[model samples]
Target: MPRGKYTNHKGRNRRFTNPEELEEQRRKDEQERRWRQQRGDESSESEEEEDEADKKKASGSKTRGDDDSGSGSEDSSESENSDEEKAKGVSNLIKIENPNRVQKKVKKLSTLNEDLVSQKPQLSRREREEIEKQRAQAHYQKLHAEGKTEQARADLARLAIIKQQREEAAKKRDLEKKQKEEALKAKTAQTQKALGKKT
Candidate 1:
C-alpha cells in the first residue's frame, strides 16, 4: 500500500502495494494484533483474580482467629516434614570438633620469630620464574668471575632483548582482545535486530 514514501536503503522496490508485499504487511499487522490481545487478556485475568482474592480475605477477617488455627498447624507440620527431608541430604563443609584446637594452631604459627628462621624467604610464582631466568644467564658469569668479561656482557644483552620482545607480544595480544570484543558486540546487535527494534 504505498503508505509512506521513503527511499529503499537496502534497494527493494520503493512501492509496496504488490500482492506479495501486501500479504507480508498483512502478516505483520496480524502478529502485532495478536501480541496486543495476549497482553490485554493476561492483564484482565490478573485483575479478576486479585479482586476475588480481596473478597476472600475480607470475608475471612470477620471469622474468629481460632477457626484457622487447625489449618495453620497443619501447614507448619508439613513445612517441618519437608525441612527434615531436605536436611537428610545436606552435609556440613568444615566440621569443627574443637574450637580451642584451631585457636592453638593459629597461636603456634604466629608466635614463631621471623629472624630465627635460617631459610631464605620464598619467592612468589612470578618472582621465582624471573629469578630462575636471571640465575641461568649469570651461570656463565660465575665461571668467568676470574676471567672472560665479554661473554658475560653478551649474555646480559641477550636476556634484555628477550624481555623486551615478551613485553611487545603482551601488548599486541591485549589490543587483539579489545578488537574481538568490539566485533562480537556489532555481530550480536545485527543478529538480534536491535537497530531495527529502536526504529
Candidate 2:
C-alpha cells in the first residue's frame, strides 16, 4: 500500500476507540437528536396556529374599539390586510427557515429541466436493446401485412418455387400414366389382329 500521513504505516497500527467512549458518544448523539426533535415540534404548525389565533383576537378587539372612531375601523381593516400580507411573507420565510424541513428535491426552472422532463428515462443496455428489437419486429410485421417488405418478397418467392415444383411433379406423373395406358392398348390390339389372322 502507498503510505501517506493518514495511512497506517508498518510502525503505527490503526488506533482503536474505547467501548466506553463509543457508548458515551452514542448517548450524546441520541440526546442531541431528541433535543432537536423537541425544538422542531415546538416550532412547527402548532406555533403558526397559535399566532393566527392571537392575530384574530387582536383584530376582534381593534374592531370593537374602532366602532366609536367610525372611519378608523375601515382604516384598521386595511392595515390588518397589509399586516397579514407581511405575515404571509414572513410565514414563507419561516417555512423555509425550519431546520427539520429536508429539501430532498430542488426545483430547477430552466430549459434543461424541460428538456430532461421531455426526454425518455435512462434504461439499461439490455432493456434498450429489447425495446429496439420489439420496435423492429412490429415495423416488419406491419410491412409484411402490407406485402411491402423484403422478407415478404422472399417468402412469396419461396412459395412460388414450391408451387412450381409441385406442378412439375404432377405433369410428370400424368405423362407417365398416359404412356403406360397407350402401351397396354397397343399390345392388346396386336394380339387381337394375330388371333384374327390365325382364325
Candidate 3:
C-alpha cells in the first residue's frame, strides 16, 4: 500500500473532505486560543498565585461593600474589576526580551569549535604523559608514607630476617661468655689446691 500524506504509520491519511469543515476547525482552534488568553493561561507563565487572586477578590468585595454603603453607582465597581483583569493579562507576558537567553538543560553541550585552526601553541602528548606519570608517583608516595604499600611489606620481611640474625648472634655471645667463666674458675681452684698442699 502507498503511504498517506498526513500519517504514514500504516499508510493512513487524515484530512478534511470539505472546505467548510476546515474553516470550522480553524475557527475552533482560534476560539480555544482566545479563551486561554482571557483565562490568563500561557505557555511561558506558571499557574497564577491563588493567594493573590483571593486578595483581589477580597479587596473587590470590600470596595463593593463601601460603594453599597455610599451612593456610588455599580458601573464604577465593574470598571475596576475590568482593570484588574487587564493587569493579570499583562503580568502573564514574558518579561525578559533577550534572544540569546539560555534554556534550562539536563545535559551539558560543548561550545568549542573543533575544526577551527589555532595560532597559539598547543600542549604536546608528552606533556600530558608527564603529568600522568607525576600523578601516579605522588599517589604511590602517599601510600608508602602510610605504610600501606607493597614496598612497606617487603621492608617488614627484610627487617624480620635481620632481627632473627641479631638474636642468634646475641645467643652465641652468651654461650661463649659462660664457657670462659667456667674455665677461669677451674684454673683458680687448681692453683689454690696446689698452694694448700705445699702449706
Best by lDDT: 2
| Residues 1-199 of candidate 1: C-alpha lDDT, one tens digit per residue | 3458774557565664664574465456445544655687666544544553464354332111212222356558746644553432223211235436745344454346654485688889999999899998788668667446787668778989999999999999999999999999888878779556641
Which parts of model 2 are misplaced by more than 4 Å?
A: 1-102, 105-125, 192-199
TM-score of every candidate relative to the true structure: 0.25, 0.34, 0.32
Give me the runs in candidate 1 sitting further than 4 Å from their true place. Answer: 1-148, 194-199
Per model, how many backbone clashes are there? 0, 0, 0
Candidate 3 TM-score versus the reference: 0.32
Candidate 2 lDDT tens digits, 1-199: 7666585557676688874674475456445544655677545434543543464454332222222221355567756654564443345222233559787766667976898989989999999999999999999899998889998999899999999999999999999999999999888889989888542
lDDT of 3 by residue, 67-110 (tens): 22211454477456545644343342213345699887554333
Among the numbered candidates, top TM-score falls to: 2
The whole-model C-alpha lDDT of candidate 2 against the native structure comes to 0.63
Candidate 2 weakest ten by summed lDDT: 61-70
Q: Each candidate's root-mean-square deviation in Å?
A: 41.3, 20.6, 16.4
Q: Compute the lDDT for candidate 3.
A: 0.58
Q: What is the lDDT of residue 28 in candidate 2?
A: 62
| Model 3 poorest ten-residue lDDT run | 62-71
Instruction: Give the candidates in order of TM-score, highest first.
Output: 2, 3, 1
